[model samples]
Structure formats: C-alpha cells, structure tokens
Target: MMQVIYDPLLPWAAIWASAAGVVLIVALALWRRLPGWWLRGLAGAALLAALANPSLQDEAQTPLSDIVVLVVDESASQTLSDRAVQTARAIDEMERAIAGLENTELRVVSLGDAPGDEGTLLMTALSEAVAEEPRGRLAGAVLLTDGRLHDVDRAPDLPAPLHVLLTGHEDDWDRRLVVENAPAFAILDEEVTLTLRIEDQGQAPAGDGLVELDVAVDGGAVRQVRVPVGEDLTLPLTLTHGGTNVIQFTTPAAEGELTDRNNTAVVQINGVRDRLSVLLVSGEPHPGERTWRNLLKSDSSVDLVHFTILRPPEKQDGVPVSELSLIAFPTRELFLDKIDEFDLIIFDRYKRRGILPAIYFDNIRRYVEDGGAVLIAAGPDFASADSIYRTPLGQILPAAPTGRVIERGYLPELAPLGERHPVTAGLPDLAPPGAEGAPGWGRWFRQIDLDPRAGQVVMQGVGDRPLLVLDRVGEGRVALLGSDQAWLWSRGFEGGGPQLELLRRLAHWMMKEPELDEEALTATAEGQRMTVTRRTLADEVGELEITGPDGNVTTAPLQEVAPGRFQAEVTGPEIGLYRLSEGDQSAVIALGPAAPREFEETVASGAALEPVVARGRGGIVRLEDGVPSVRQVREGRPAAGRGWIGVTPRHAYVTSDVTVTPLVPAWLFLVLAAGLSLGAWMREGRR
Candidate 1:
C-alpha cells in the first residue's frame, strides 16, 4: 500500500514573524528594560515552528468503475398474466442502458416466490445483494418490481441512490374469492359455520355489483349464494360423510376478470363420530344382565340392541301363538344379512338351543368368515349338552369346551398379550374410593373350562383354565370368554378390570382394520420421513426394504417396541409418495401433501411488480422479442423509455495506492517568509 505524511505546524510561521518584529521594536524603544523570559520565549517559538516540517507525497493509482445492483423480482405474483413477460423485457432494456455508461458495471439478482403466506421479500434480496458486492463500489440500486414489498423495513444504509421500476398497468384489476374462517372438523348432520370474503382490487369498483358465489362439495355445486362486492359473509354448512370431506366455494368468473387463481377456495372438514351400533344377544336375562347394558350405555357412541331368549324350545306352554305374546326369531336377517352393520356382536351366557336352527348357526359361521366380529361369554351351557361347538363354526373357533366346569369364585388375570391389547389392556380396577382394601371386581360362581387351539389365549380364570381366547378365522375374528362373570369386573368382586377396553379391541379386531391387527405390517410418512412397523409373532424383524421417490433402494433393521412388534424409520431425499416392504408384505404412504400449494401456482405475470420496474427508469417488455442490447447512461439518467432502461455502476476497489500533501511547500514558506522580512528591513533602511 502507498503511504503519505504531513506536518500540522505550517500556519505557526506567521506567529513567530510577528513576535520577532515586536522584539526588535521593543528592544529599540526600551533597550535596558527588555525581559529575558520574553526573548527566550520568542526564540523557542520560532525554532520549534521551523523544526516541525510539513511535506506533500504522491503515488500511482488505477481507476475503478462504480457498481450498480439491479434487483429483479421473481415472486409468485409475478407469474400472473403478462407480468413475467414484462419483467424479462424490462431487465433486457436495463442491461443495455447500464452497459453504455462510463466507469460503471452492473450486478443482477432474481428473487423467486417464498413458501406458505410469504409475499414479496424485496428488502431481504437487496440486503443480500449489497453484502455480496463491495460497499464503496455501490453507486446505488435499481429495483425492478411492484412496490408491494413484504419486508419494507429492511432497507440498508446505502451510499448511493435507489430507483424503482413499477411493472403493472394503470388499469390493472383483479377479483378473488377468500375463505375467511373454516373449522377443522364438524359433527355429522350438524351445521358448521364458514366465513368468506370476496375482494376486488384496482379499478374494480364497489357499486351495485353482485358476486355470484357457487358453493360446491366434492365437485358438485350445492348452491349459488349471491354476495355484495367487498363484503364478508358467514355461511352455515352441513357435512354428510364421516371422513375427510372437501368443500369448494367459488365465485362465478366475471367478464374480463384478471385471473381465476383467487376465484375458488377449498376447505376440508373431517367427519366426526358420536355413535356406534352394537348388537347384544343373551340366552336368557339374568341378575347380571344389567351390567352389560350399563357399561355400553355409558358411552355416547354406543347404540346397543339387546335381545333375550326368555324360554327355549325345551319349555312347552299350552298357549296358542296368537296369545303367547312371542314372535319367531328372524334368524336369517340377524346372521345372514346386515351382519356387517354391527360394530360388535356379543352373546352373553349363550348356547346352542332349538330357538336358532342349525341353518342359522351355519349362517353365523359365514358371518365371521366375512369379517364380522363375535364375542361369546360362556356359562355352564358351554360345558353342557347345549354347547354351540357342534355347529359348522367348530372348524374356525379357537376354543373347545372340555365338558368341565369350575364352581368357585376366582380372581381374573390378564395373559401376556392382554397387557398390550387395546381391548383387555388398561381395564380400570374395580376397587372403589376408600374401598382399596377390597378386591377389584365381582366373580362368577361358574366358568366353563375350554381347550386352547391356534388362537391367542389372552386371559385365564379359576384353575388357570382358558377364560378368553381370540382368533381370526378367514377375514373375521372371534373372542371366546369361558365365563359369564364379566359382571364381576364391574361389580368389583375381585378387582376392577378393563371390561370396556377389552371388549372394544375384541370388537374392532374382528372388523379387519389394520390398526387392530395383531400380526401385520404398516408404513406411514410425513414430509420425507417414513416409519415402518412390523406386527409379527417375533420380537424383531430380520430387515426391511424401502423404495424411495428417486427409485433408490435401502434396507434397515428394526427394534422391538413391544411384544410381537418391530419398527424402523428412514427419511427419503425427495418429497412424494413412498413404499415400504418387509418379506411378502408392503405398505404405501405419502410424506407431504398430495399437491404443494406453493409450487402449483406457476403462471407468470407482471402486475405484481410492474411499479418497481418503472421506478428504476426501466420499462416492461415481452419475451417474444430477441435478446435486447446493453447501454450505459449517467447517474439519474433516463435509462429506460419505450423499450428499455439503462444500468448504473459505482466504482469499487481494494484500495491500491494513496497520496496526501499540504497545499503549500516548506521551501515556498521559507522564501515568502524571507521576502517579507527583507521588505520590512528595506523600509526601515529607507526611513
């Protein structure tokens, strides 16, 4: 680096000159009275002033051109109509205009759309551009976009002036349909409220204008609701389905409408559940029958239908059918048809009787095979001659009565699997408040002893005999409870049990839902992460294979989270659907939304940023034209007119050489000092 130095004492020479002259005149007037200190002070001031020298130094320097930054907006709004076309035109013209200027260069930046509700972040782009270039070189900036900047407060401490180029037409206008407020979920058959707003921008004035709003569900128009201009309306909507229901509200496209992007809004309302249908059949009503009713009735979602065979065919009464006040059972309707409608089917203390013929028993077997669920609470009849084991269901049922019965009260205990099963798991203890000393639940006097087969043995009663056995037969599932003592769980004879939870899981498992399955594989994804789970007989899976969005394959080992289950997780590099597999089973899942709303809006327009372009002394142009030429103009010069605008440059450098000097030289100072002193002396001599 070049260096320079100078003295700060050049102006003091005049002081000493006056002091010396005073001394000479005073000495001549009062030669004997002159003070020695005054002479010494005067000499010191003059000598010190001459000792400190000031000089000029110079060095060679290479000139640098000024730098100018051109920030062009590329946000989502710019993709509308001819906005993108106009932006391209303006940039070309600006480039040509800036190229022609002397001692100037240009830096161009393009900003695209942001995710979510992010609008134009112009200030962030400008800050980034300024940081990349040398600050000293920055002459100023030219912003080519609409003035609607999302981050307006991020303006920098600029060393140069900033200009804006607006990109919109004078009469640009648009109409948009907005869904103001929507609920995430709504009850079935109940009205849900939704708020909406219809907005018109630019020259679209509010008058007697009527916006025809056509509300639709699943692509069908429900109604054409008329709304006033710039008005907010609240509409009540009712949902029919029980799952995700998509409701679309749109306004009729008016003549000469700017674009249809804002004309339609989609709102999804998930269906709510408040009730469940349950069918309960009893061999005969007993003292504990009320226990089942109370347990089911406690839930708002349960719609229980209870039926009892008061007297079997073995009981003959001397009464005519018309006078007997009893109707023949609709066995075919219950077992053959509409069996799938029931979420749970319970047979309490039930057994084979003449009331239901062999044909109905056969139909019941088919019901289970068709994915229907069945829960059997066996009494003494289960070990007696009236047992239903001899029916066609014998082939799929997981338990067989041993023709033996226990008659003593015993505590109920969960099997190893029952602790994790949703049905039997987490049952409440029967012990009441302040009664912690008592057993949890009531017990039954009798329980049938049954032999376990291929199904899972989840619970045991007296003597460790199988009390509850669950098994899947084809697509259906069956849960056999060897005792009719479930009332004991509610009665708190032993300790309270999870009567409700056990029954719920047993009921749903038979419905073939993947979530309730004991041995199954399922995969779920969010974003690019995928979770692979294996519900198997073993604690850990050997390995899992995954196919990514990019067609890459990877295998992962899984850890056991619980009994008879294994799971693994991996994140893919892409955003889309994915598939996971283990051995013969596979599952497909999605990470992100089916369609990303941000990237889907792909139209290019100029209305969003036209004003920014115009502010930079640049005009809009269409991309149809060939490559435009570059030109340079002076600062504050009109670079863009009908077809183009100019670019500016602010000289920047890593400073190479520097020189500094005083205006006057030491020799000139001394000569001028001597000349004046000589002139004073000559005047004295002439006098």
Candidate 2:
C-alpha cells in the first residue's frame, strides 16, 4: 500500500513567509486591474506549495490466516444416541474444509465432561479458544454438540459470527427420574419425606400413563409401585439404623428412551437418633455411681431414668417402713409395662435381694431376648451366692462368676477379641508410663473372676480372667463389665484413660450402631472417589466387589489397615450410582450429587444457544441433515444457508516491508512557480 509523506525544507515558519508574499502579490494584481490577476494569484499559490514539501508512502504486506474455532463436545451427554457419531463426522469434515480454504486455519478445541457433575461447558471452551488467537484474525466459531451446554452465560462477545452444528436426531426423546429434594439426615425409626418426580422430554410418549417405580433401602429387597408420570410423588421413608442409609429409587426405562442413565436416582440420607432412652438402675451408691450418672447425663440426647436402691428390703434397723422418705420401686411399671419403650436397660451392682420376685426377673430375661439391650456393670456383689447371675437372668448372661472376687489391684487390658472389636479397637492407648503396651492406661482394683458361658471375651483382668463379655440372645444384645473400678480412671488415678470414649462406644454398640457392627461392608463417596471398607471380627477378609454405574463389576483386594478393619479405594470416570459387596454383605453408594447435571436433561435441543447464534447473525443446522458445506462469507452478514455454513473473511494481514518517497521534487515545484510568475508579468506589460 502507498501513503502520503512530508519532508519540509524550511519548517512551518517558511510556509508563513510564503503565505504573506502571495497575499501581497494578489492585492497588487487586483488594484492595478491587471488582466492576468487570476494567473498571478495561481503563481503565488505554487510558490507556497513548493515551500511545504509532500511525499507518497508505499509498503509491502503479507496476508495472515484467519482463525476459525471448531469446538467439539465430548461430555457425558454427548455420548447419548447418535450424537457422538455425528460429532466425529462433523469434526473430520470441518477440518478438511478449513484446510482446503486458502489463508484459513481450523483451531480444534475438544471439551470433555465438566468436572463434578457440571454439564457440557461449550461456551466456556469456545471463549478460551478464541482468547488464544488475535481478535482481528478470528473468522468465526463453529460448535458441534448436543446443544445442552450448562454454562451458556459465559459466552464471549465474538468478533465474527457464531454457528452451531447440533448433533443427535431432531426427534430424540428421553424419560428421566428426578429427586427434587431429599434430606441428607433423618431421625432413626422416624418417617421422613422424599420428593421425587418422573418427567418426559423431547418427543415424549403421547399418554400420561403410570410407570413402575422401585425403591430400596441400603441393599435390602426392592419394593415396586405404580406411579403416574410427570408428577411429583412424596415418599415416606423410615431409617432403621444409626448411620449412613442409601435409599435408591429406580424406574424401568420406557420404550424409545434415549438413555437409561437417568432412569435411576440415589438418595443418601444419614440416620441419626432422635433421643436415646436409657434405664439406669444402681443397686447401691458407690464411687462410680456419680461417674455413671455424670456420663449418661452429660449427653443431652440421652433420656436417663435412674433409680438407686438406698436401702434393701433385707436391711431393717428398727425403723418404721411407712415413715421412710424413699418411694416404692415400680417393678411392674418398669420390668413389665414399659420395658420395651427403653432402648437399653443398665444394671449396676445388683444382688438378688428380696426386693423383686422371680416373675419380674423372668420378664427382664424375656425383654433381653426380644430385641432389647442389657448392660451389667458388675461389682463384688456378683461373686456372692445371692448374685443376680444366680437369678432368672443368668440364662442370658454371657459369663458366670466362679464365686471368687479378687481384691488385688490389676490393669484392665484388651483381649484378642477386643483388638478386633469395633467398641474397643482404636481407643486411645491408656497404658501408664513405662508400660509394656502403648496407652497402658490406669489400673483397677478388685476384679470379679468369671468363666465364659457364651459369647466373646473382649477384656481381661487379673490372671487373664474374663473381665468384659458380649453376647447376643435371640435378637437382643448383652454386655457385662466384671469390675466396678472403671471409676479409678475417671478420677484421674495414675493418669486418666479413654474412659468416656470407651463407655460411649460401648453404649452405641449395644444400641446397634451400624459403624460398630461386628461384620459389615460399607462405602463412602466424596466427589468421584470412593472408599470401600469391610469391618469384621475375622482376621482376614475376602476381596471387595464393586459395581459401577455402567454395570461393570470389578474386584479390589482389601488391605488390613487396623486389627480387623479392611479398606480400599477407587475413582470413577463418571458421576452416578455405585454398588459394593463382599462376602454376604453389600451396600450402595451414590457418588457426586444425587442428580448429576449431565443427565439432568439428555434430549438434544438448540434453545440454549439460539440467542448467541442470533447475536452473531449465525444459523443452527441439525447434523441429521448432513455436515453442512463450508463457505466464505463477508463480515456483518448472514452466515448460514440451507445446507451450508459460512465463515466470515477477516482479510487480516501483517506488514513485511515499506518504501516512502516525495510525490513531487522541490525543484519541479519551484520551476513551475517561476514560469507562471514570468508569464503573468509579460501579460501585464503587453496590456
């Protein structure tokens, strides 16, 4: 390209001097009535033009290739129906067409599934690709996707037109199950509401018929029910255990459905106890009496019903029974009437005095065998002939006293069973200083020796005698603590131990906490990562079987991280539901959100990107018709036709070299001015 240039011989000051001379000459010609006045004025203008030099500039330019963005969607939704195949074909054809066009290049930007359930972010990907190139070189943007982008609000202001080559057939449709709202935590044994709906998108079925819906808790049996389509259904679900509860709802795929990925939904609700009612009966007041009361009362969630036998019926010091301040024991009300109302019944150092009848003890035993929990914090009284073990409750007790109570001080240590038992495992090592084992906690005096009749021995006292034993009778559970000196640890004797934690775990275990189950298989999900764990009393566990959302089964060997705890982890490629099983135990875990964004809407449509296309003067073309032919169009015009897509020609370039010279020489201008002045003077003289 050539342009004007200036090289002044005398600066702007000389232009002013020539202007004055021209004005004076023009005035003299007009005043003298000279016939050549016009010629004289023209001569003065020429002289002034010579003083102000001018030039022409010429440069060499090199053309720059236009940048055309081709965004390909590889998100999870794009794999539905024929969208993937359409995208592959469109990408190949577009690449070839851009390659054939002179001074044009294709910048391919492949977008994968958005992280953490965020759907296809086509606009975000396009903006990034455009940012990598110069704005002046951007020809236009072309996107190949299912048109279900999640981040359309992030679309960039395009320098050229933006077109969308939508994948999938125009008549594609999908039926999906949606859990509109679900509580993450629910009170155990209480009914909670789950809001769910079933809807059809795209070219849905013509009828408003009922669909078969199946619901299951944890991995239990599935219950099926017929539910009307396209309406929100409220489900009343009750939790059974105190821990994570996975409630899965699934609907059979309808005919002509796009994909089954959205046909099922998982809702993980944690079961929490509303209030734990504990019946605490203390046979006689002792140092540990306050300890037990303080521990139980410290927790606001526990409703404690405490009764202490201040005086036994056998004790009489010539005092009138009617004048006493104590109230009569409500044996019938507690042992028979509302026994099942309480979750756990605790007996602390009770001897078989004449206070209760044999029928009452029998009822207590029946309560234990019928899904009720019982805990015995035994004292020296258990070794006596009148011990409670000698009563009707003895049949359900895990151990029987040998009628010997050792009065010597001894350290309470965990037995082999306790090492693997969830109640005692991983407790703070309370071993005293210079002890053989870590956390050799404090010591206790006076241990009641007992022989195991049934169940497992979890703790030992003097001479390796059974100090703590746990057993199950029918559907209920029982635990016995042979010594009453746990209060020594509470009093900080020789440094305190994990007395509070130990008691808490024991209480929760007796109440059937799922985390404390002797044998269980469970999984936890955080984003796409899953941790599978197997808790068992056995020393070795088999491999853990995992079933992914895609129905693929894989087995992962569990490594013993603790005495009886085995665990392993796996990361999934996509977000959805998963199942875990090992031995006879199984569980279901829902990774990521309950309803992933990718499958929230599986039908393909152009509604999301229509506004963007209109702003860029671009058109939406369905890939079902075929990959549209590429054409070069002028800027600021329509860029799409029946079967063709247009890319605006930017005509962008780069400067290589440049040459500038004067348009006319100073000597030529000066000579022309002098000739005009001489001609004007001769004309005046001739006149």
Give TM per candidate.
0.59, 0.94
Instruction: State each model's CA lDDT, in order.
Output: 0.66, 0.87
Q: Highest lDDT among the candidates is held by which one?
A: 2
**What TM-score does structure 1 among the candidates reach?**
0.59
Give stretches of model 2 more than 4 Å off.
7-52, 99-102, 320-323, 428-438, 670-687
Give the lDDT of residue 353 in candidate 2.
77
**Model 1, poorest ten-residue lDDT window?**
593-602
Off by over 4 Å in 1: 1-67, 70-276, 316-333, 336-343, 409-411, 416-446, 462-464, 523-530, 601-608, 619-630, 634-637, 641-645, 649-687
- Pick the TM-score winner: 2
